[model samples]
Target: MRDVAVISFSQLLVDKAEANDAELVMPVVREALGRAGLQKQDIGFTCSGSSDFLTGMPFSFVGALDAVGPWPPIEESHVEMDGAWALYEAWVRLQHGDIDTALVYAFGRSTLGPIEDILALQLDPYYEAPMWPDATSLAALQARALLDSGRLSDSDKKKATAEPPKIVDGAAAVVLASGDRARKLCSRPAFISGIDHRIESHLLGVRDLSHSVSTEIAAKHAGCFEKSPTFAELHAPYSAQELILCDALKLDKQVTINPSGGAQNNNAVMVAGLIRIGEAATRVSNREADCALAHASSGPCLQQNLICMLEARA
Candidate 1:
């Protein structure tokens, strides 16, 4: 492996932030680059995760590129997926010897519409579209399935915690580097130890929503906890899904789950995943834990999942 690492990260809240999307992204990008001890010109490439649906227009991300100053031109791509996948793309690019540093980011504003209704677009528009079901209903279905399995009590299947998610609208950015460049940027870089994303079938009705088989599959491939993860941050939009994920990761009662609150507290679609990874990295950076598991999800009822293990070195 190329030993890529996250050197710096930044975030802005979703609903509470007053700035427009482009305005929100610029400072975040600047903060990330500033922490990396480099300027925009130093970045090897840039990748972002965002959905056009959220903005009600195509190429919405193209406007975001302006936040970074495109006069000079830079390598970049945008995914219809979440920022978590965008980070994955940058990680993959680092596999080659030529690239040393890159930037990844995501942004979402749920207040623009009934997010559940908007998310319906991710479905196949064929058989699934006819139902016109929103994410909440599908997650409820998953909640019911878990209850039926007798795996958890009704209370355990509730929303994450009393603490509200940081629901304000926001954006987040991170800079990554490999080899010597990584060492030069930070004294303790949160290395991209293992990263993987998996997607379940689009038809919510066909799959077993009760469990995160995708997470389990991702964990195995993602080389979980080099040591036991003392902390874990999972994207569970509902209370029930939190219980399901804990079971899927076999997280045991010992791990600190979502001290950063999680999606239930506040969520912006594109950046939420980046926030999860950032939370995990922060724990490692602060010397609170040697390793941590950060998970991000997309699609209805956790149809897609990404597991990233971040490790800190002495």
Candidate 2:
């Protein structure tokens, strides 16, 4: 496999609750294109991640495409998943050698519904769905398990929840390239050094609530989770899950966590996981982070997770 680098990134503020989806995403998309020294048409491909259930309307991504402009139908695709998954597809397409670089992004207004109940749809239909365990309640079950295990203190968990959960509405985008193409585009390219993702059983009660199997598997697939010098940006929807994942990955004090304040600080539904990846890439592009780990979660209690390692090369 070849290396791909995220060359640029842009994000809309979390506070823009009034703007519709198109208005929220346009600025971030243009800003990312501008930073990458390209125009919309110059992009070889485009992909996005978002969920229709959040807005009670399907094809939310189609409206998002209106931001790119008329006709000729640019090569693009959309995922009913997190933006990180869209990024994953973009990376895979780049591997085929036909595409040099691609743009990936996502937007959402999480406040549209009672987050807990809304997320229950991701659970199993037969058994778990009937119980109607909400997102927070499922997360709380994980938190309670962690506290019971003595892996984390209630005080330590407070670090992530010190502020109100960022029940936000916004969008994030990133541009990526390979080798020389990346070098020519930016003084420093935040190489997508490594990435991997996996899924666990969907039943929240069936899985070990205190651990993330997906995280463990993804770290191994990425090939440096055990011995690497990098800060980690994790999409821990709740503070306790962050602690549990840290233990599963065995990340130590050497690894700085979530300088971006993470999703617990501000949640944007389906796209929040992908935004974590963008935040890490932005740090590398700006030269503030030499190497970093970006993590994302899906399903209740992090039943699915993705890990990407990024580095800046001049």
Best by lDDT: 1
Off by over 4 Å in 2: 153-164
Q: Report the error of model 2 at residue 104, Å.
A: 0.6
Candidate 1 C-alpha lDDT tens digits along 77-162: 88888898999999998898798999998887766767777777777888776677777777778777887777675567454332
Error of 2 at 10 (Å): 0.8
User: How close is every model to the real structure, measured as TM-score?
Assistant: 0.94, 0.94
Error of 1 at 195 (Å): 0.5
Q: Whole-model lDDT, candidate 2?
A: 0.81
User: What CA RMSD would you report for each candidate?
Assistant: 2.1, 2.0
Compared with the true structure, all predictions reach lDDT values of: 0.83, 0.81
Q: How does model 1 fare in lDDT?
A: 0.83
Instruction: Give residue 181's lDDT in candidate 1 (0 to 100).
Output: 83
- What's the TM for model 2? 0.94
